[model samples]
Target: MYKLYVRPGACSKAINVLLRDLDQKVEVIDARNLEGFKSISPTGAVPAMIDEQGNVFVEGVAIILHLLEKHNSAMLPKELLKKTDFIRWLTFANATMHPAYSRLFFLNSVVKDEAEKANTMKAAAAKVSEYWQIVEDKLNKQRYMGGDQINIVDVWLAVYAGWNAYFPVEVTIGPKAKAMIADVQAMPSFKAATESEKF
Candidate 1:
């Protein structure tokens, strides 16, 4: 069995969804309540895992790729080109899009001056919207980021979309992107993860 540590509503939610979707027997631990969490994940990040063999894994994308490949999940493409596309969109979501939202979170908590916070947060929100446009454009080509079927990237972006409620900024997600998120959220894995986290 796998042991997964997660913070409610964090990117860890994606990992939770992935574990369930893969039908992996996992024990979910809320990192917020766990003492000495940094000992497991030195960076104190959620979405960290301890595998059956007792090997520890940290970082969301790394853990996700490891599980998908290890389990030989159909969600991961077997073809060379399709696999490349999978990695591309995964990076776009984790590396590109996630940081854009991180900026908003940082500004909200760190900026003491209200006017400065608003200005910086506005800029960050614009950048987030820009990324959403890229997502919208991609979805215009297909039903989901992974083509006809939903993929982990879709789950990741849907989890990130939940953060919009935390900030006062208006991040404009397009209609297509919105629909995609809705679909991802409707999945049993996503619903189970959300409910487990009490979100």
Candidate 2:
């Protein structure tokens, strides 16, 4: 059995959805109450996983990949080129888009000075908008980030996009993004993971 340490509605939602989608039997632990989360993850981030063997892994992208690899799901294309593209989009969402929004949302936390925080929020909002435009373009062309079928990349991106409702970011994907997210949420697996957890 694997134990997943997560904070509700955090980036960990992606991992939870994926695990349910794969139908894997893993214990879910709320990191908010779980002591030593920082000891497990120096950054004290949510969505950390500990295997039955006691090996621990942290980070949303890493955990998603680990679950996909462990399940040996056909959803993850085995071809090198396809896999590379999957990785590319995953990295873009995790490293680029996620951080950009973080900066925008946490402007005050990131910057001490009031004027600097306002400036940072302004710049970060533009960058976040640009990134969403890129996402909108890709999603408009393909049903999922990995083309037709839902894959790890799509799940990961959806998790970040889910935050749009909570945070004020101009998401131009419009109806398409909403529909795509609806499609994923409609999945039985996704429902199972999110039914008890607030998203």
Candidate 3:
């Protein structure tokens, strides 16, 4: 069994969902309730996993790829070009989209002046929306970023979309993007992860 450390509603939530989607048995530990979390993750971040072999993995993308590749999950493409595409979309979701949303959280905590904070968040939100538009346009051509099947990127974006509720920004996800998120969330594994996280 895999031991996954996660914070409720965090990007770690996506990892939890992916684990279940792969039909892996995972013991979910709430990082907030765990002592010495840094021992598991040096940065003290959630979504850290200790595989059955007792190897520890940190970073959301790394853990995700490790699990998918190890399990030979169909969500990961085997063809050379398709594999590259998988990595591309994975980076887009984790590096591009996730950071766009994080800007809102960073600005919210640091910007003290209400006006400046609001303005900063609004601009950050616009940036996030731009990323969403990219997803929307891509989804218009394909059922999912992974082509016909739901992949880790889809789950990642779905989890990230929920973070808008934690900020004061007006991030507008396009209709197709919203629909994609909804579909990803409706997955049995996604539902199980959300309930396990108490979200």
Q: Of 1 and 3, which scores higher on lDDT?
A: 1
- Separate clash counts for every candidate: 0, 0, 0
Q: What tens-digit string does per-residue lDDT give for candidate 1 at 11-125?
A: 9999999999999888888899678999999988788999999999998879988999999998888999999989999999989999999999999999999999999999999
At residue 109, give the lDDT of candidate 3. Answer: 91
Error of 2 at 118 (Å): 6.3
**Each prediction's RMSD to truth:** 1.2, 2.6, 1.2
lDDT by residue (42-82, candidate 3, tens digit) is 89987899989999999988888888889988877889998
| Pairwise TM-score winner, candidates 2 and 3 | 3
Worst 10-residue lDDT window, candidate 1: 190-199
| Model 2 bad stretches (over 4 Å) | 108-122
Among all windows of ten consecutive residues in candidate 3, which has the lowest summed lDDT?
168-177
lDDT of 1: 0.92
